[model samples]
Target: MINLTINGFEVEVEQGATILQAAEKIGIKIPTFCYDDRFKPHGSCRICVVEVEGARSLMTACCIPATDGMIVQTESEAVVEARREILDLILANHPLDCLTCEKAGRCTLQDLCYQYDIEETSYDGARKSYEKDVSNEFYTADQTKCILCGKCVYMCSQVQNTDALCFVDRGFETHVGTPFEQGISESTCVSCGNCVSVCPVGALMPKRREKYRYWEVDKVQTTCSYCGVGCQMELLVKDNKIMEVLPVTGHCNEGLLCVKGRFSFDFVSHSDRLQKPLIRKNGELTEASWDEAYNLITSKIKEIKESDGPDAVAGFSSARGLTEDNYLMTKMMRAAIGTNNVDHCARL
Candidate 1:
């Protein structure tokens, strides 16, 4: 264990813990622009710079490991000034279109600027004029809004294992995109949108129907129904409509979702979606109440069981249903119905 004093609070953390981790253990909030818990910290943003008791200069809290008897000040006067300057430099080139950008409510850069009381950039520097990459079907890449944090690049390459994006050019001209600065559609990009989830700014925005503010939606946790993997996810709903699908870190997917799991949730609110139980009468399917449908199903199943035995009434549970529901279906078939003709659609 290593003992460190972060913002005057003495804390102990396991060996190899970073200064940022130590500060967090002591309830000190050190803002970071390029830190994502899913990957290793590279400390490229320098926004989490902090003052150590005897260090030569400010050290990035995200990357610098905490040492025994270390005294760290995460929000000291010098550290705050350095962070403010870092935000100023980032804002100088970043586009000031938060109101129009869909990422406005959740943008980390915007929050930092507000925290440091920077209403606008003081530097009138040259901003990148790269056109938006609308080639990808799932999301768009606006380089002008990018801060070159490399979070998307790291997520795509390290987590998704697709090296579709890389740093192109150098210095002020640098931006992350498909290899050789090619369009996302023309490269090895899979449109998984994992990179989009990791992005801290409006540079990578998901393409969706209508815009939504963060506070306008109520998050509802549910499992992805695209497959039987049972990946945990959250449904961002507004006015009884699904606004977005965000992956939740749980037993199955661990905060990562595939292209279908992330972007194929529109069907939930489609007009063609079936809401009521349907009964086939005279070869025509008609909507029926739940009680009526249950009565018809019970009579038909009992008739078939009496005429040709319980084996005649086979039950095929769907994979889309919950695991517990499927288990109950199997139990009813073997115990109550006295048949072994129960199976799952996944087998077929």
Candidate 2:
């Protein structure tokens, strides 16, 4: 354990823990954009700079390790000014279109700007701009809105291991792009959406625009039912309809998701999906009451057991079904039906 003082409050954290993690442990909110648990701390944003006693200058708290007997000031006047200046520079390049941006309420950069009261930028220069890349069917990339924090680039390479995004060119002209300046749709990207998940601004956003504001939507935590991996996700719901799917951190999948679990959710609300039990009547499939469906299934099972024997009965469970549901189905086939002819799609 290493002991450190942040804002005059003594706190102890595990060895090799960064100052930002130590401060967060004690309920101190340190604003950051380039620091996430899934990736290495790059400290490119310089938004989490803090002052340390005997230090020559301010240090980025996100990557600096906490040492024993270290004294840190998280929000001194100098630290505040430094953070404000960094934000000012970032906003100089970032477009002022938050009012209509898809990431308006949920954007990390917007939240930090509000926290630090950065109403405008002090630096004025030619802003870097690029044509919007909407070729990626799932999301759009507008380089004009990017702050070049490198979170998305790192996420694509380190976390997702896709290496689909990279910084092109040199300082001032540097920007996130694909290899050979091709569209993301033409790259090796599998559309897992991890890059979009880590973007701090509206630079990357889903193609399907959400209808409600961030506060208006209710985030319901649930496990992804697409596979056996059991990746957790947050369903952004508005008016009983799912607006978006967000990856949940620190779960079985560790805040990562495949393309299917992240983007193949529209089927839930598809018009062709069955909402009730259907049974064939008069040579056509028609909706049936729950009781009627259960009665018909029970009668058929009894007839098959009596005439063809229990060994003839078989059941197949879907991988999309919950674990408990599949377990119950297996138990019913073996214990109640007196047959072992049961299997799940996931096993196949």
Candidate 3:
């Protein structure tokens, strides 16, 4: 264990731990942009700069290894000024359309700027120009709002193991793009939207949410119904209508979701959803009230029991239903209907 002082608090951490990790252990928050816990520290964005005693200059806490007896000041004036200046530089090139951006309220860049009290840009010049790439059916990439932090690139390549995005060109003219400058729709991109999830700014956003604002919907936390992965997500409901889906943090998904879990929620609003129960009457289907449907179902079960025994009555449950519903269905089948043939289509 290596002992270090961060924000005047002495703490013991594993040897070779970065200052960012150590500070995090002691509850000292160092704002970061390009640092993901699952990825190797890139240190491209210097927002996590901190002052180390006896060092010539401020070092990036994300990549700087903590040595024994090292004293780190994370909130000194010099450190705060350095972080503020770095954020200002990032904001200088960032787009000023946060009000309309889908990531406006949840953006890390906007949160960092608010933390450091940065309200206006100091540098004034012609901003970089780039067209919005909406070729991908799942997401949209706006180069003008990109900060070149490489979080999307790292997430796409390292996390998802799909190298759909890469840095193109060199220096200030460099930007992220698909191979051959092709749109993501024409590439082998899996459309997982991990890049969109980790993007610090509004550079990458879901394409379905282009016409909506951040505050225009109500977000409800719920478990995903796609696969057995059970990833958690926020269902964005606008006036009782699902507008979009957003992934929740600190859950089983770890803020990452697959393509189906991210975009395949239209079944909730599908036109075929059974709003009312239907029964065949005189060889024609007719919508029935809940009471009538239940009574008919009960009479059929009684008839089947009297004619073909209890084995003829079968009940099927849905795996997508909640735990309480599953338990109740099992209870109703075994106790109320006296049937052991209860099963679910999901099992098949």
Candidate 4:
């Protein structure tokens, strides 16, 4: 255990805990953009810097270990100034297009700028005018807005293990890109959007699937139905329609999702999708309520059983259904319907 004083409040944290973690434990707000638990802490963004008593300079609270009896000032004058300077530098390169940015409401960098009350950057130098890389179907690679935080780079190499994204070029021209200046779609990139998930800014974001803001949508936590893995996710629904899919920390996936779970959710709100039960009435299929649909199905099954016997009604279960559901389908066929004519769709 390590005891540290953050802004005159003494707090105890477990050994090997960073100062940023300790501050968070005590409900102290320390702004950080590049810090993510899923990846190793590199402290590229020095905005989380704090003043440690007797230390020569401000140290990043993210990567700096919390030492016992260390008095840290998370919001001291010096610390605040240092953080402001870092924010100013980041803002210099970042585009002021938060109004229409897909990540506007959810961007950590946007929140920091508001917290520090910085309307704009002080420096008026050359801004990055990199061409937008929208070749990837899932997301756009906006290098002009990138702060070089390296969170996306870390997530790509470490978490996804794709190593598809890297800091390409050198110094001022350095930008996250694929090998040989190729598009992500042309490279080894899997379009997992894992890097986009960890990105703090609008540098990497899903291509606009829906015209809605973060606050406008209601996040409904649900399990992914792509496969039997049962990865947890949140459906961002707006006006009773699915707008986006956000990954959630659940037992199965741990806040990460594959391409299908992340980006292939447009089918939910797609025009071709069957939104309701359809019943053929007067030679035309019409929308019907659940009760009407179930009643019709029950009546037909009963009529079929009486006229043709249960042998004529074979049950085919879907692979998408749960194991217990598949079992119940077979059980109904054998016990209730008096037939063993049960099979799985996968076999066919």
Which numbered prediction scores highest in lDDT against the true structure? 2
TM-score for each prediction?
A: 0.93, 0.96, 0.83, 0.85
Please provide, for model 2 over 41-110, each residue's C-alpha lDDT reduced to its tens digit, 9 standing for 90 to 100. 9899899999999999999999999999999999999999998888888888888887887888999888
Q: List model 3 lDDT by residue over 195-220, tens digit each.
A: 88788888998877336666788989
Candidate maximizing TM-score: 2
Return the TM-score for candidate 4, rounded to 2 decimals: 0.85
Model 1, residue 216: displacement in angstroms? 2.3
lDDT score, candidate 2: 0.89
Q: In order, what lDDT does every prediction score?
A: 0.88, 0.89, 0.86, 0.88
TM value for model 1 = 0.93
TM-score ranking, high to low: 2, 1, 4, 3
lDDT of 1 by residue, 45-76 (tens): 99989999999999999999999999988778
* Candidate 1 wrongly placed segments (more than 4 Å): none
Which has the better lDDT: candidate 1, or candidate 3?
1
Worst 10 residues of 3 by lDDT: 206-215
